[model samples]
Target: MIQVENLHHRFLEIEYLRIGEGHTAIIGPNGSGKTTFLKLCAGIELPERGTVTISGKEPRAVNTGWVGEVPDNNLVFRTVADEVASALRFGRVRADEIKPAACAVLSEMGISHLSSRATHTLSGGEKVLVACAAALALPPEILILDETDTHLDRKAAENLETMIQRRPAPCVLQCTQDMDTASRADRVIYFEHGHPRYIGTPEETFSHLYNTEMYPSLWRIAGCI
Candidate 1:
């Protein structure tokens, strides 16, 4: 289990709150420190105080795979195939194994055709798929998804959900404004002013916060407003 102990992060005089994890969903209004908290968990930034542990090991010390907010930021190679292959290469897998591995990953994401295309030329949604494929190729103990659903259309989102469900990991931490995604989570953490105001099942958390039921349609309504 991923455990966060007395975690505290501060920027100048402002303090971003602390939290623990167990199949968590970090939800909050804008500027509630959700992104910052995810960044700390991904070890992209260090917290000022306290500690974050992935299965009893520090995040940096562990082989934690992170898919950042911007998919393009994660791409180092020119082609999508190269980008996905790079992950396997990092693990010292042989050349013959790379194509099959990359093919499987891309096919799972339903983007196999684009594998030969230049990563920089793909659309935002396409880039997210490439980034996700690369992340899955490495299979980390902990997977952190940062607002990946935001760029996806309905069909793409469903495909993404399917892929996420199939990939089993010890810990899955997703930060999203999509209530559809939030409702699927095992537990949800609602943030207000950079602190967890509510932590429970999605139904319980949303019921207390909105004084209404939690449903996929509710998210649609929220999106319209």
Candidate 2:
């Protein structure tokens, strides 16, 4: 479980919020604090006030896997294999075990063919997948995707979604504008003006957003409203 109380950082503020284990989609207009909230959860930025904890520990104490909107930002190494192994190296997973572990995750992601390639030479979609592979190689306790699908095509997005649904992490937080994608989450958080205005299951959350563009098109086709 993730807990937040009196969260205040820059433009974001939350009196209290609790997020349980599962995939949770966060949706809202631009500058609504979606990314800020994820950053806090990922321990990338400290809240100026209050506390944020995961599974009873401070977020910084937990291992976190993060894939941001820009694929290049998540990647640091010059080569594919090294990039995937970077997380393991940082986590001090034993020298001899790193290569095999990276190889295993690349195979799992079906991108082993790109193992020897230079990271800068890959296309945007490929880079995103590589970033995803690196994050999952750690198999972190918290997985945060900050508009990661923005860099992926339809098929790639579907592939990533499949990987996510397999429970790579106990709690997965994705901030996305894709209503269809958000609609599939186990829970939904709708933010507006730096506050979460709605939080519940997809059906319950969407019920509050039916009249807005945030409503999933698939739901409309199914006559859910």
Candidate of highest lDDT: 2
Best by TM-score: 2
As a whole number from 0 to 100, the lDDT of residue 58 in candidate 2 is 89
> Candidate 2: lDDT over CA atoms?
0.91
* TM-score of every candidate: 0.88, 0.96
Candidate 2, residue 195: how far the Cα is off, in Å:
0.4
Q: How close is candidate 1 to the true structure, as a TM-score?
A: 0.88
lDDT of 2 by residue, 101-203 (tens): 9998888777899999999999988998999989988779999999989888888899888877653699999999899999989999999998999999999
| Cα lDDT listed for each candidate | 0.77, 0.91
RMSD to truth, every model: 3.9, 1.2
Global CA lDDT computed for model 1 = 0.77
Off by over 4 Å in 1: 11-23, 212-225
Candidate 1: which pairs clash?
none
